[model samples]
Target: MIQNTVPGATRTQAQRTAATRAKLLDAAVDSLVEQGYSGISTQGIAKRAGVSRGAQLHHFPTKESLVVAAVEHLVDKRLMEILESQPDPEYGFEALFDAFTGPLFDAALELWVAARTDPALHAAMIQLERKVSDALRTGCLEIMGDRVSPDIIDLGIELARGFAVSALMRTPESDREFRERLLPVWKALVSK
Candidate 1:
């Protein structure tokens, strides 16, 4: 038999498999953000990831599984980022608001909107949303434990989410002014 020759090839089969799975999951999130839920499909995800369909199928047998896994992966990544950031003593609330309103929320909002009509997607999202929410709450507590009450943290989260949703309609300049006006209010509320 001819000897097999593969350059490097240090990664085991399992490592390769995990790397492919991660690629697929990341592509799924990109699809959700770019195309929304209705536009997402296994084939599209595989194509986006530059992986073979067989590899995608082997990793996630169904579209639901793929999307759910992507959502979980995205949430975990965002939570870790939030948890790792240094909390600014004076601007902690601003930092937290920015964290909650970034790309992670955009991806999640897309899923939530799509889930409203799709029962299977809704079920998957509901379970994952709770976990994401809890992780965010815990992160907030950790970041603001000394300065803010838990109840205020909860309220601030709701306020930030609402502001994020509403800010979509405002111009960047107006949004900046809006946040500037509201930051003091939020600081006062949390300080109590």
Candidate 2:
């Protein structure tokens, strides 16, 4: 009789670890959004996540570590939302660009402002921003190649990010205008 030493148990262990991580991140977000950076405690997060305090601490031994992971998770979720929300391919890159930029840019800029005052959060935010920029540059270079050049794409991206930063500084009405205005710039730069 063979003992049940199947790989399934290992896979289950990995799944449980992932689920626990997600729960911790979720709890951290809720706490941070509600209480800001200073107000969150590990016990509070554990209660929010419905996990044990020891478990929460085990996953994130330091407050700084927890905050950094929370920020990164938030940024990653933002990217996934944009990537998943793409309309049918027939609608094409124009729609895809609009969907990804408008809301994401505004929120990201606001988060950047908040992060500026906190070193751990600043590092986390910077890492996410660089990831997005690198991904964009890679995609643009692959499609446009030598014809357009990386410098041109880089410049345009900076310009768009500038516009988004300005939008976050404005009132809601003006923020809407900021998003609407970017379409022309995007079309000119990327459209064939």
Q: Which candidate is the best by lDDT?
A: 1
Q: After superposition, which runs of candidate 1 have C-alpha atoms over 4 Å from their true positions?
A: 1-7
TM-score result, candidate 1: 0.88
Tens digits of per-residue lDDT for model 2, 1-192: 444367764445656777888999877776776676667788888888888888888889876677567756665665465446643433333333442354344344445666889777676777777876776565555444465667666765676566655554689788677666766666566556
Q: After superposition, how far is residue 40 of candidate 2 from its true place, in Å?
A: 2.8
User: What residue runs in model 2 are displaced by over 4 Å at the alpha carbon?
Assistant: 1-11, 84-111, 114-126, 136-149, 189-192
TM-score of each: 0.88, 0.63
Query: Which consecutive 10 residues in model 2 have the weakest lDDT in total?
Result: 90-99
Quantify all predictions' global Cα lDDT against the true fold: 0.81, 0.64
RMSD of 2: 5.5
Clashes of each: 0, 0
Predicted structure 2: clash tally: 0
Q: lDDT at 112 for candidate 2? A: 64
